[model samples]
Target: MEGILIFAPFFLIPYIMAHIFNRVNYSNRWMTYIFSGIVNLAYSVLFDFISSYLKEDKSQPVCHFPLFLFPIFFSPFLILLQFMFNKAIIKSVKYKRNDSQNEQ
Candidate 1:
């Protein structure tokens, strides 16, 4: 339960970032992908740093692998998720606009 709680942001943040990036720069798909990847990488590094800092014991294992490597392992998946999310958001907005225009 605690582990799930700790890792929830790894999945959620990318979706949120995708929505934000799509809103901010809907014209450029590549830019949205690049920016979302950068943001997720930064977030992974920051999360590792904070978790390490908050640990009370230096010797006990908090994670199976090195904390610094967490981003490397997870970044690709996060970026892919962001890409998919951005595409979905763009499609939804396009449909919404079309619907509204047709109604007018």
Candidate 2:
């Protein structure tokens, strides 16, 4: 739908970026968390701005500002998920190497 089209990037990009960063084993998990949160907030604000501009409405939605804070919840969760993801990737790579060495 139209709503999904507008909001998908706000939710999706940070998740994907976090996952990618995790795979690379980034040292600063907190920085990544904050970066993702800010990105999410910016995207959400942009979505609201675009919607309001298209609708030609001067009235600001009450939920918009509150919604910006939603990223706070995701920040910690994203950091944990990234940590897990990095561990998994490291394990998988080690397992693959071990298996290859065993065959040779």
Candidate 3:
């Protein structure tokens, strides 16, 4: 669990942000979700690479999975996060547009 802690913020923060945007009925929520996933993937890849390079001369391992394998583990949850956020955004937008149309 401690090991997970290091990567937790990278995933958790974006997940939380996506929920916040969904609540606010932000336009382009799908785009935001996609962008966040891309950013998270990039962050995981970059961090693994850098940490692997640093570990070469040390006795510590930054991750249990191989360098390329880290993204595989990170991807599913990130994609799920995107899907949920995108759904919320779609519903919120639809609701707001309907509300406005009714008002008019």
Candidate 4:
């Protein structure tokens, strides 16, 4: 019960952080990818880091720095991966729109 409560929002990180600044249908897509990745990495890791510090019992049976380090170093890659997925979704939608236009 408690476990689910703690972990559920982790699943929605992308949708929450990824959509805020994305330039859907923008021309310069590389910037979109780079900025989106940067924001997601910063948003996720920074939020977790700050929240951990805010907790009453900061020690949760582990060394916090190492845990923080993992996300700090790894989040960029994950964010970029998320960006790619977003781009793919956008591309598919654009394709569908074009198909519908052609049919009309």
Best by TM-score: 1
Clash count per candidate: 0, 0, 0, 0
lDDT of 4 at 91: 47
Pick the winner on lDDT between candidates 3 and 4: 3
Between candidates 1 and 2, the one scoring higher on TM-score is 1
Error of 4 at 53 (Å): 3.2
What would the TM-scores of all predictions be? 0.59, 0.51, 0.52, 0.42
For each candidate in the order shown, give its overall lDDT on alpha carbons.
Answer: 0.65, 0.58, 0.61, 0.51
The TM-score measured for candidate 4 stands at 0.42
* Candidate 3 lDDT score relative to the true structure: 0.61
Clashing pairs in 1: none
Off by over 4 Å in 3: 19-27, 56-65, 85-91, 94-104
Q: Give the TM-score of candidate 3.
A: 0.52
Q: For residues 1-104, write the lDDT of model 4, one tens digit per residue.
A: 53453344333544543454355544544454465445545555665666677779845753446434544565565566657656554343244345766777
| Number of the top lDDT candidate | 1
> Which ranges of candidate 4 are over 4 A from the true structure?
1-26, 58-64, 71-80, 92-104
- What's the CA RMSD for each of the models? 6.0, 6.0, 5.4, 6.8
Look at candidate 1 and tell me the lDDT of residue 65: 51
